[model samples]
Target: MTVHDIRAALAADKATVGTWLQLPSPDVAELMARAGYDWVAVDMEHGSFGRTGLPDIFRAIECGGAAPFARLPVAAKTTVKAALEAGAQGLIFPMIETREQLNQAISWAVYPGHDDGRAPDEPLRENRGVGYCRANVFGKDFDAYMTRRAPELFLVAQIEHIRAVENLDAILSHPRLDAIMVGPYDLSGSMGLTAQFDHPDFKAAMERIHAACKRHKPLMGLHIVQPDPEELRRQIAAGSRFIAYGIDSVFLWRGAERPR
Candidate 1:
């Protein structure tokens, strides 16, 4: 399982760019992958794709040489397991507001015995191990997959709620958490200031998040919906290593409208 080098890039404080796939078409996914994004996330929360359709899209993205990631609808164990089994090299768990939630999300994303020397039949059996799936090439690649690929799986917590901002320190301190993705719209809405990116309180929230990221050293992620070069550069300058640049639908819409 060849994966993107996002983990090392983020660890070394280098910028990594990715795009969101909101459309359900594998062709669109492949196109985005081939455009040279470090990662391509399938938006299960807002996209038309569901569990049944995820694996194929993941395959398509991998075919184009980009790591496949999934933005889960919620931080649920079943959803995380399903996405991992479908070949998502990483996950973006939405609406995280507490340390416990982040911890649970990490637990679900990782195989228990892989980190700790616990038996599969231990007291927490069901919650610990992942069954043979596409992630392990359906058993053929189990050894290499566990030893090489699993360690690089990225686990991101989306900080969308005001409470998550307030609890940022504890959430960032989670040992297994790899990155923090900010959902500006949802964060603003949580603060009763929808779409007010320039509002003082919203700016303050972002400041706190950046400070926490600096303190904890996990990758700080921001979704630059417009994909302007200057804005991308600005975000990278501001310590955001995980940059998600726009969605598939919007990119297509804009490209279609451009004069030939």
Candidate 2:
């Protein structure tokens, strides 16, 4: 039960770039960990990985030294609880639109009985990371488990709506928010230009997000398909810290698209 310091690692210039593993199998997660990613998100928002398949993926991420984060379908309490209990070290809620939703998202992420306002160095939050029965009953020491698992389970929110952009200040100012990710597709749609990455409105939205993020200091992420190395470098230069490079199906479709 050892946890990887993903935030510190990211701060130390360790490229935490990872792909979205939409597949149900743990093998993909294991493979990505072996590839030395900082973390991998099990895409429950779009992937077919329901309750049963997600646990194995989370375990695989731990075994690989890559953090396990789940992109829940929404910022619902039950969904977040179930994912965390299943051993997901972090969460990413999709289609976020308001500050109220962000606060609600943190409410679901933290332990139910404990107060959420603890000093950073305190162990209140750490004590509440009671893992699932499988991990707990397996005779894994809880403290060791937490030392390895608790602190790293980041609560990330995806900001995609133009309304969210309008309320960016309030959203980013929430104390519990650990990171913010951009849903480029939904964002483009929000801008009235679906899937057009080159659209002026889309670029403007990205800039606004980047600019607003500077004020809050949470990890900022962008979603890209078939991302190039140079583009990754450029984003890092622009102050983006979290990144999702590709998804499970993209690997398959891109492989199929290879020029033979």
Task: Report, for every candidate in turn, its global Cα lDDT versus the true structure.
Answer: 0.84, 0.74
TM-score of each: 0.92, 0.86
lDDT of 2 by residue, 1-260 (tens): 22356666666855457778887888878887666667788888778887877678888888888777888987787788778778777788887787767766676666545445443553432224345445443446665544544444677789888888999888887676777889888888887899998988889888999989888857788776675779888888888887888776777786688697
Candidate 2 regions exceeding 4 Å error are 1-4, 13-15, 113-132, 135-148, 258-260
Q: All predictions: root-mean-square deviation over Cα?
A: 3.3, 4.1
lDDT, model 2 = 0.74
Local lDDT at 253 for model 2: 85
Clashing pairs in 1: none
Model 1 lDDT per residue over 1-260, tens place = 23446766665778889999999989999999999899899999998888888889999999988899999988887888889999999889999999777766777776656552233442332343667999899999998888888877887889999999889987887776778899999999999999999999999999999999989857789888877889999899988988899899889888889687
Single out the weakest 10-residue window by summed lDDT for candidate 1: 116-125
Q: How far is candidate 1 from the true structure (C-alpha RMSD, Å)?
A: 3.3
